[model samples]
Target: MKRIFLIAALICSSIIVLQSCSPKTTSGAPAVKRSGVTGNWVLNNITFDGIPDIAVKSFLGESSYKCFIGSTWSLTNSGNGSYSLPSSATCAAKTQTIFWSVNAADGTFQFKKLYQGDKAKNVTEGYRLMLAAADDVNMTIKSPIEYGNKTAYIIMNFSKAAK
Candidate 1:
């Protein structure tokens, strides 16, 4: 079982998940969205496709995906980052440390939970989200879940928040 939100210090660079989004720049060079992954981000909303809202009990093994709305995420260049869950009427306030990275060519974003004294290399189980889009101010990641012989997606929408 794994928790969520681990990337390192915000040094100004991040993941580039743009396999099909490799638009050529003015100079005809491939544009990478690496810079879009770093910095402070807020999970503004979550949308589900082909899955009932009541079907899921938790997201990332932490809490209900509904509870994740408004969560703040920080992904650093060093592969260390954290997400803060603000206390709500139904959700408790929590901050989780994580180690995260992306397979840019494949448009995959993955992260592992970091418990005290736990090494990332030793933890094999992690959560993966498909990067639908990641620009300077917004990012969309999709978590695919298998349900009743069908694949459903949990779409997370995030917007950048300046430090």
Candidate 2:
């Protein structure tokens, strides 16, 4: 009888521990805001097969008329396996929200930009966000969109501020 009670107690304790260890899911609402991308991000490198590298560099660097480093943006977790940018509208004529959904196991982030227009909008405007970290270096950026489409993608990468 004593052994049976001990085993039951152990089982209950194990169940509690497992439940506590699980990660809680967000309910498609904005949860935590990403604070890492609030500042400037400079372009270090860009590559796109078939297309001219200059085009990628220009978009990533925002060199034509806009500066990616100077553009003000914000990041917020959508709680539904994605994140929203600028919970408020700040860009000119760009009343849209951008999202970044990354696989927690793979680190490959999908970049999406959703517009507020009556039209269905476009996904070609979406890109990917990648991150790499090592003992000596850490990098983050919006990667290029390879698909041919009418929308343009602005990809940029940045390193963390030096200590």
Candidate 3:
């Protein structure tokens, strides 16, 4: 009787352990949905206060615009990524390599300028872009900039790059 009881207890303990160690599953349910920003994208347009920005139009019209080829903005599932500007961009829109993140709670996209090989240095304090909309293939972002005495919305649109 003692031997039988000990064996039964051991088997029960083993079964409990095995069940706890098993991988969890959702029983054929789909995985968590990823954010739409997790891919390479190209700048499509820029608008300032509901009007097309001439500087952006001129920048796109320049011959050096070809240099923007292969330049990409990449976001991650974990809300962090890198943004690389085209090398040949104009002085005012010069190349910038920065780290970016999305704040889902506030619907804001935050950017931090990485400097001197340090990810924590030269951060842009309080500079955040409001995400207007984002689908699998497109995203629109808006930021307020002081234009003269009033604030103007700088809207940027991006299209996802082909795989």
Q: lDDT for model 2, on a 0 to 1 scale? A: 0.43
Per-residue CA lDDT of candidate 1, range 58-109, in tens?
9997768877899999999878998999899888999989999877766778
Q: Point out the worst 10-residue segment of candidate 3 by lDDT.
A: 55-64
> Each model's TM-score, in the order given?
0.78, 0.37, 0.57
Q: Report the lDDT tens digits of candidate 3 across residue range 35-74.
A: 6567778777666783335433332323443334445677
- Off-target runs (Cα >4 Å) in candidate 1 are 1-33
**Cα-based lDDT at residue 137, candidate 2:** 33
RMSD of each: 17.1, 10.8, 11.0
Give the alpha-carbon lDDT of every model. 0.83, 0.43, 0.62
True-structure Cα RMSD, model 1? 17.1
Model 3 segments beyond 4 Å from truth?
1-34, 50-71, 78-80, 87-95, 121-126
Please report how far candidate 3 places residue 123 from its true position, in Å.
3.6
Which lDDT tens digits does candidate 2 get at residues 1-163? 9999999999999999999999987543222224333332233433344455455534422233233433333334541222212222322322235555545444445556555552223456555555332112333443536546644434444443343
Error of 1 at 4 (Å): 66
Clashes of each: 11, 0, 0
